[model samples]
Target: MDLPQSQLVAAHVQECNFVQIIEGLVDSSHLGFLHIDTLRKSDSSDLAYAQNVNSMQHALAPKIGVEDTAFGFYYAALRDIRKEGESRLQARVAGFIAPFTVLNPNGDLHQLVIPMTDTRSMFIHVYSASRRRSTRSRYAVSTCGWWAWTARHCSDFT
Candidate 1:
């Protein structure tokens, strides 16, 4: 909740409906499958991100649990993790804020899918980290790569 340090990355997707983007955001099941290459290449040194990707990779099918809230709803993708010969359950929870905002399971990431037109949308990714820990370098590299990829493939969607 306390995000003193923040960065925003926005991408324009042509010929894509905002609702479609939101649906994709809320579907945790596709993360490992869709981004398997990225996940497989994740650096183990990158604690948080790597751990999340590892969990996702190990559990392709997670049990989904949803709960309604006044603003919108929150959902959890429950996965199994094995460590030290012991098995445990890991729950990755994310929330759908009313309108078009989504609170990612990481807690620091928030996404907004805004409609620019009936067939176009602006996808904004907000990375908000605590002041105690700086994510400047990581954020910069990630956004730069994302922008480059978007620039190269954006036309495909049109």
Candidate 2:
């Protein structure tokens, strides 16, 4: 017998009242700058996690394309990739589920940004990718734990 599809493998609810978090989610331009210490990495034996940053895709102003979908809105961030005489557009697509849900392209990650009170918000994150469970879990743990441990030192955003 086959089982039904599960959209949510794990859900984590966190308090992140920063109104700018949503903006940070939608903006690819900050990927290189703000998350210079975080974001982007895989299983690499030689390279340390702290030494890896997806610089190629960071600080890039992607050609944004948006369409009103039945569910809500569909947006694509197109990055230019060229080699020799060849040209291509690498796309990262995301779907906004009306009020606050966002289905991200990678790791089957979905985020729901809900405002609870002034200066307080709940970020509901759901991850569905089961194949790369360990990698995803490590990344999530590093991001949450490491960021929390070092957030106090980050003063540029304010």
Q: Which lDDT tens digits does candidate 2 get at residues 1-158?
A: 24234344333333455455566665555665555445444223233322222432342667788889888887777777554567666676777777787776553667777776655455656656443232233223323342122222222256
Residue lDDT tens for model 1, 17-72: 77777877788888888888777777454667566657677778999999999999
What is the alpha-carbon lDDT of model 2 when measured against the actual structure? 0.53
Query: What overall lDDT, based on C-alpha atoms, would model 1 receive against the true structure?
Result: 0.69
Candidate with the greatest TM-score versus the true structure: 1
RMSD of each: 5.7, 6.7
Quote each prediction's TM-score.
Answer: 0.73, 0.60
Cα miss at 113, model 1 (Å)?
Answer: 1.0
Off by over 4 Å in 1: 1-15, 130-149, 152-158
Candidate 2 regions with alpha-carbon error over 4 angstroms: 1-15, 37-59, 83-86, 132-158
Supply candidate 2's per-residue lDDT for 51: 27
